[model samples]
Target: MNILTELAQIGNRLDPKGAISFPIYHSSTFAHPGFGESTGFDYSRTNNPTRQVLEDAIARLEEGTKGFAFSSGMGAITTILTLFSHGDHIIVTEDLYGGTYRILEEVFNRFGLQVSFADTSNLEAIEKEILPHTKAIFTETPTNPMMKIADLHGIARLCQKHGLLDIVDNTFLTPYLQKPLLCGADIVVHSGTKYLGGHNDIISGLVVVKGEKLATRFGRLQNSLGATLGPQDSWLMIRGLKTLALRMKAQEENALQIAQWLLNHPKVTEVYYPGLKNHPSHATQLNQAKGFGAMLSFRVKDSSLIPRILKSLEIISYAESLGGVESLITYPATQTHADIPLEVRARLGIDDCLLRLSVGIEAAEDLIRDLESALR
Candidate 1:
């Protein structure tokens, strides 16, 4: 069977009634079979049948040894950072998501953990920033907003040479388009709220570990931190995942059309989508992943046109989040990457004129007309 077929078949074994839809185990705790024995789940935080199903599915899809589901994407990121000690340092992609940057600079920095931002697209830049205390390389391929691609296999090899953990945020491309673990990452993380959730209905995060030791460590941290996803949300994630392969295919198709249209538009100054032949990392992306994914960013010729364009959009939504079933646009300078210092944002080219688009499962022609109307 195909992976799409396999995804849709998740949780069938758990449906004792043959209802097709998996039942949500809503109980907070499982009953014990005996005084000294338990039914595998003692508490929801430690383990829940519904959450476990979603976790297992993600692990299988990513080809990892184990999986973890968290309350939110940030929760998963925070928990993963706990694996490092106070003095341990990390090298991260300079153009990664704003939330990740905020967490590292605002939350973790006070705890004594250090971070160095480097252009991970440039292998030499990454090599130069590795400190003696550097414990890991955290990066986002086809990075948030900017759509900057990183050389996953190369970075993984470099990490191995220095004994550093290779951590990748696979939220943008997702496992359907790219599997980082298969390309040599040690751990893969996702904001299930976006693509994996598919509907913008639930906020969740996922972690998949490449080995048993890392799985065991993450499991312990998840249980101890009590940031696990609830039964209902877990069920939602499972449902959303069932149609992910279909959703991604449609969304990527829409994205490519929009990107090409934008490249020739009079108001557009630049287009950043890895699918484009002229993209800086187009060859590397083609070599590492199955597709360019449905995320793209472009810069308008004038910053003054932004307000009018945002207001004129009919089919597309001016929103903060991405990877849903509806086309959404975001102003990264104010909305997503605002947490970064102005100088840093400028350096990374996430300026006032840049707009990020998360294409949906809409007809490509309709989306193009919507953009045309907005630009007019």
Candidate 2:
């Protein structure tokens, strides 16, 4: 049977139990009848039917051969990056999510893995930085905070030519909006804490591999390294995925209206949203993503104005994390991107006044009004 059919069957089976809404396989271990012989599951970490179902759904949605669910987004990334050895090198976008930048610059460096942050938007710059030790190219298109758009197809082509793995963080634009695997990426990673979970209550990560070989490799690491998502969290993500398309549609609209509003505001110095016609990546984002995505950023006319604007918000919460039923506003320089050095953040245009918003499925008019009142 097809994956969709399987998902429907699972839903149908659980519907009668009334447990489908939130099925809890709270056990840490599964009982096995005999040595090396099982009732299909030997351990919770190695396998869980609920987690499997979610993984299957993600794999199908991303059009990947298989999927691995992890404890967190960083967990998924670490698993993939761990595949390379000490001397191996990785090239990543300079404007990546700050957590990702921290991991590459801090943890990976200590492990003897050489990494270089490059402007993936510029092919020539990426080429200039590539070394013989380079084994992978990592990127996030419509990148975190900055909304910088990288040419996924172009990078994938380069990876193919060099026989290097291309890993794209598809968190900002979920499978519903943009499937990087279809664009030739070898691995598609997600901070399922974002749109995939939609509710923000669950912390989960997913990795969808392009083919059976890569899938097997990731599976081995996932099982051996043991960062698999809990059964309960997996169920949460699965349920959330059902409403992703719907939520994203509303979020895209909300984000577009809000971005336009910010652009016209006198106190707003600049808006960084691919939906805007003047945005550098507007055309490219349009070509790849279904919508401009729910994430947007803007800088205030003065750095001192930020505290007032943040305090003035009635609807959007000043917080870390994003992608939920409720909107969130984050000061990236102090919150999400704090780990990156001040010099590096400034180079990437993430100034102190920059505010990143993750629009929710709330009424666009209400959200716009909230922003208007805040900026006033």
Candidate 3:
């Protein structure tokens, strides 16, 4: 069956009731069939029917053996970090999400996980940073706000040679656009709250592991951490996954149109989008992924235009989150990447003038007009 068909019928086959929509099994506990026998669900925290459908769907979509759902993207990330132990070293993407950086520096560092931030886009650079204790390389291709693209295939090669785990954050480009596991990734993570959930209605995170053993370890951590997604949110995520194929196509087309327009605008200094022909990672992205995705970032000619652009937009929202039905614009310096030190942000090119845009399913012409109106 086609993946789109699989995506649309996510919970239908799982539901014994033959429900067109996946039913939300809201009960926290299930009655055992009899003493010494189980109905497959003992408690909601450990597992729920509704969340199971979502978890299974994500696992299949990413071509992995196991998947876990979490309360938020950070929750998913935190759980993955816990896989490491005291004195375990990990190499992370340099232009990373601020929240990930915070937990690595403030939370995990204090607990004894040694981490080194490096430019994962450059395979040689990552190789040089590897220590004897290094256990994994966590990467974000088309990294948050900066739009740096990593070579998933190259990273996988290095990981294979060094006996390290290869993990990729696929939030920007969902499974519809890219499947990191197919490219040899050991694990794939996503802020399902973004593209997977489609709307800004719920917070959810998903992790898909390549093998059963690794997946079981994550499953144990998920239940132990107790940050798992609720039955309600899991159902919401199921509803969103149904329309993923359509939403992703629309978002990508709109993003490409907007990125092309930004290149010619006098006020726009530079545009960071893999869809653009001139983008540094265009060929690399083409080789590893099916599409370029909906996110793009551009810098204004002057920092003064920042406030004007943010406040002037009417159709596009001035907000922090991305990969939604509604268009959103964000300021990295003050919004998404603020936790990182100013010196580091400057080096990564996440300047005060840089504005990241999460293109939506809105008509391309209308979105362009909105940008034109705001840039004026």
Candidate 4:
């Protein structure tokens, strides 16, 4: 079946009444028929009727054995990290989200979890960083704002060879564009609040794991941690997912136009988008994913233009989050990458003039005009 069809059919199977919208089980607990037997859903935290539909939908879409939903993206990530032990070391993308870095450094590091940042776009560099205690490789391809692509297949093969788990943050490209599990990753995760939700209203997190043993362990951890998404939010995510295919394609179209436009402007020194032929990972993206995705970043010629561009924009919102229906522009130096040290941020090319744009499903011409007026 086409992914578009799969996305739209999210709640169809579960709703036996043929209702167009999936029913939300507001009841935190379900009544049992007998002492020894019970309905599959026992509680909202462990599972809920509405949440089950959403989880199953993502699992099938991502081609994983099972799926788990959480209250927030950070909660999902935090649960996944719990799978590791105190002495375990994890290799991660050098340029990743600030929140993930913060958790590893401030929260997890205190518990004795070790981390080493590697340029995951370079498989050899990642392999070189792996130590005897390295348990997994957590990668964000088309990494955060920089838009770097890592070779998922190669990373999977390498992980298999070393008996390491291959974990991928598939939040940016999403299952609509990239299925890391299909590429042989052991686990795939998403900040469903972004593209999966397609709207900025609800915060959500999703996880899909490959094997039964891992799924069982993951489910237990999820239940114990108790950050499960509420039934209301689950229904909202389902509604957001139904329109994801349409939103992603439209956003991709708008992004390509804006990226090209940015490429030509004299004030714009560099544009980082895989859709561009000049992007370092263009071919790799062409090979692994369905599209180049809608996220892009660029550097302006001078630091002075930053404030003028941000303040002058009419349509695009100056915001912190991405992957919504509206275009959002983030200043990485002080926003997304602010937590990283100044020296580290400079080394990663997240300078004062850099800005990350989350292209939306708005009209390309209007978006371009917004950029033009902002640039002026």
Name the better of 2 and 4 by TM-score: 4
Candidate 1 regions exceeding 4 Å error are none
Model 4 CA lDDT for position 354? 96
Tens digits of lDDT, candidate 1, 1-376: 6789878998887766776878788998888999999878898889998899999999999999999999999999999999999899999999989999999999999999999999988899999999889999999988887788899999999999999999999999888999999999999999999999999888999999998888998899999998899999999999999999999999998899899999999999999999999998999999999999999999999999999999999999999899999999999999999999999999889998999999999899999999999999
Ordered list by lDDT, greatest first: 4, 3, 1, 2
lDDT of 4 by residue, 223-301 (tens): 9999999999999999999999999999999999999999999889999999999988899998899998899999999
The whole-model C-alpha lDDT of candidate 4 against the native structure comes to 0.94
Clashes of each: 0, 0, 0, 0
Each prediction's TM-score versus the true structure? 0.99, 0.94, 0.99, 0.99
> Candidate 3 on 189-292: residue-level lDDT in tens?
99999999999999999999998789888899999999999999999999999999999999999999999999999999899999998988899999999999
- List where candidate 4 sits over 4 angstroms from the true fold: none
lDDT value, candidate 2, whole model: 0.86
Report lDDT (CA) for all predictions.
0.93, 0.86, 0.94, 0.94
lDDT of 2 by residue, 262-281 (tens): 88898988999888999887
Root-mean-square deviation per candidate? 0.8, 2.4, 0.8, 0.8
